[model samples]
Target: MKRVGSFLGDWWRLVIPYFRSEEWPIAIALLIGAIALTFAGVGLEVLFNDWNRRFYDSIQNKNETVFWREIIFFSWLAALYIMVFVARAIVSPYLRLRWRRWLTSHYLAHWLDDRGYYRIELTRAVDNVDQRIAEDLNQLGQYTMTLLLGLLGAVATLISFLFILWELSGPLSLASIGIDITVPGYMAWVCLIYAVVGSYLANLVGRRLIPLNFMRQRFEANFRFSLVRVRENAEGIALYHGEKREADSLNARFIDVFNNGFRVLMTQAQLAFYQSGYAQLAIIFPYVVTAPRFFAGVITFGVMTQTASAFGQVQTALSFFIDNYTSLAELRAVMDRLKGLQIATDEKPPTAIEVMPQPGRSGVATEDLTLSLPGGQALLENLDLPLEKGQSVLVRGASGTGKSTLFRALAGIWPFGRGRVRVPEGARVLFLPQKPYIPIGTLRDAVRYPDENSRASDADIAAALQATGLGHLTDRLDEVAHWSNVLSGGEQQRLAAARAIVFKPDWLFMDEATASLDDAAEATVYNALKKQLPGTTMVSIGHRPTLRKWHDRQLELKRAPGEVGTLVEVPA
Candidate 1:
């Protein structure tokens, strides 16, 4: 019960916002409409119960006029029922979509804000974030609509039918069954007991489904993620001829999915068996209970028929939870995943590194800065470096010696560090990693990314591409393709350099941004930047000795065994 309460608390946090959001008026109105339709449906059921008694009485009496009149009455009732059902079907899903749109946009903002996407990955707090955002949100919307409407309908049906069952049930005596007992409204009490027992048994049979569904979602997402990974790296796998290895890994992931799916199927089968029997038995149990009174002439055939119908309605209303156990389990799983994503995205990282703007500063500066690996091993310690405007510096260090990490710190992304790194106020800074992220879009968009609506003239963009040795792509700016997969590594780096020229930031940090190009091509790219953007300050990480002459000064990171590296000046 405590666990259920906790689950409901989380559910409220997810659901209440939609009804109180800017879209609240429409959402609340639609919800009220849907709810009114639900009760109208219950009203139709009660009307049918009355019609059942009259129709059956006419049959027993063989009265053609009464039978035909009742049939016409039912036609109108059925029409109204159909209308209510159809309206609810349409309005309920519309409500779900509205809630879904708001929820998807809300989560997208949080997941993308403050680099939450990157931090989530670095912390590894949640798995399959893409699946959580895409599939889980969709499931949440669908399941919430189903469960909420089902519950409301159940409550309305119970209220409507319970009174009818109580009024028609009369009384029962157990003297003939070797017991001396009398009960009032015995049929209503029977339904309450039956539903209570059935619900308890259903909960027992299906409790394991909660965790099973959770694991199934994870397993399916894992398998899907593996397939996407393989597709993204198809070129590298083909180059290595690793199809057999890839196939084995993929098959193993599928095995996890299959095994968990089998378990779920088994549990569902158990639940289905119990629920089916319970329902089939309900159909006959009400008739059996009322037949004795009818045979004793204690009631008319109409009374017996009405009593049975009301009993069925009451029982059906009470069995709502039993019928929706699997859906409830599935909803629980989705809620857990979404809650986990929310917590992870909202959490602040523990590291104490701080980056802020210093007024009157012209370039980047680090004071008493220390950096570490994600696992807390020191990478660089107490390294103070001052970079002035219009100066270019090349940073060199051995592989795994924190060169790229230092660049990350300077870019204000590496959070696993301490102390302060300050940059000039209102300065435009850009970081170019070894592999530039080329979003799947047109060449013009890729070259002018982070500025989707760049106003730079085509001629200016074309010149930048030509100067970076990518003149062939100048005319294809509007052609859309997966540019990252289409371009060679050297061409990609040159494209990034072209992007840098278009951006024209005040400070540019490149972490081996030109490693893919040949020395001559790299020199051409750097020299072009020197002649065109002479005021831009540059910090670069590279191992090539040919890169030394482009920078006016150099900082090399040096580390001894089991100690953090320190940055020192070196000759250019």
Candidate 2:
């Protein structure tokens, strides 16, 4: 019960926002309309129960006029019933889509807003964000609709039909014990007991499914994510001859999927055994209980028929939880995932090394700067540095000395220590890593990324491409393809350099950007940058000794035991 309440509490957090937003009026009206239609449908059901008694009486008496009159009445009742169901079906899904759209956009905005996406990927290293957005939000909205609508219908039906059932099954005695247990609503009490027992038993059979379902979804998403990662990095994996290892890893994840799925099947099987049996036995149980009253002539076949319908409705209402418990559990699971994503995205930046980029054209400046890891291992501590326009510096260090990490700090991404960094506000700053991100779009857009609407002409973009010796791509800018996979490693780096040449940012930082390029190709690109953008300042972190000629100065990092961070110095 506590767990279920907690689940509902999370669901409310997810659900309540939509009704309170701008859609509140329409959503409320549609909900009220749907509920009214349902009540009308139930009203028709109660009238039909009366018709069952009268129609059965007419048939027993062999009266043609009464029978035909009742047929006409039922035809109208059937049409009314059909209209009610049709109205609900039409209006409910519209509401569902509205709610889903609002929630999807809300989550999408939160996930992508203000560098949350990059921070989570780099800092937390949590995988499968795409799955969380695409799959989890969709399922959360869909299941929330299903559960809410089901609960509304169940509650309405229970209230309307329980009274009918109390009137029909008559005063009661315990026949098994032959004792007078004089309860006015004995049949209602009987139903309450039966429903409570069935629900309790069903909970026992299905209680483990909630966590299992949650794990299954996460596992499935993870496995799918791995497959996509392999596809995206197929060339890298192939170059490393990692197909066997990849297959083994993928198979291990799938095995968990298979085992979890099998467990769910077993559990559902257990739940089904009880549910189906209860429904089947329900067919005869009401008749058996009221049989003595019928034989004593206290009621006719008509009453017996009406009484049976009322009993079924009551039992159906009572058993709703038993039937829907599993789905409710899954609904909660999806809610939990969305909540997790929200929390992960909204977490405050670490207070230690977080550097804020200030607005200036004074060039990149840092005052009393310190950078540290989240674990408090200093990358660079108590360091002060200034680089202005036309200054090119190379940051050099042994591997794992946090050369790249300090660049992240300057970019305001690695926020684990205390520092202040000042840079030109609204100044175009670009970071080109060892491998550039090739967005899946036209080559032109990918090259001009983070500058999607830049005023750079096609001729200029084309000339930049030709300068990189990728003249073939000069005419293919408008043509769309996955350029990352289409181009070779060296070619992609050349393309990345071509972008830097094209965008001509005031400041450009490259972290091992030429590691994959040969010495000749690397030198050609850096020399081209100097010729093309004479005023642009480039800070590069590279291991190649040949790179020293392109830069006027170098900041080399030193790491030692018992030391927390890298020490930086400007070489003569």
Error of 2 at 297 (Å): 1.8
TM-score, candidate 2, is 0.94
Off by over 4 Å in 2: 123-127, 173-181, 352-361
TM per candidate = 0.97, 0.94
Tens digits of per-residue lDDT for model 1, 1-572: 99889989999998898899999999999999988888888889999999999999999889999999999999999999999989998999999888888989999999989778888888788999989988888889899888888898899889888988988988778897988998888888989999999999999999999999999999999999999999989999999999999999999999999999999999999999999999999999988988877898888898888888888888888999999999999999999999999998998768667888989988788988889877888988887888888889999978877888888888777878898989988988888999999999889989998766677778878999999999999999999999988999999999888888888888889999999999999998898777767778988998788889989899888876567888888965
Clashing pairs in 2: 352-417, 352-418, 353-416, 353-417, 353-418, 354-417, 360-424
Give one digit per residue, the lDDT tens place, for model 2 in 459-509. Answer: 988888887768888878888898888999888898898899888888989
lDDT score of residue 79 within candidate 2: 91
Q: For each candidate in the order shown, give its overall lDDT on alpha carbons.
A: 0.89, 0.82
Q: What is the number of residue pairs that collide in model 2?
A: 7
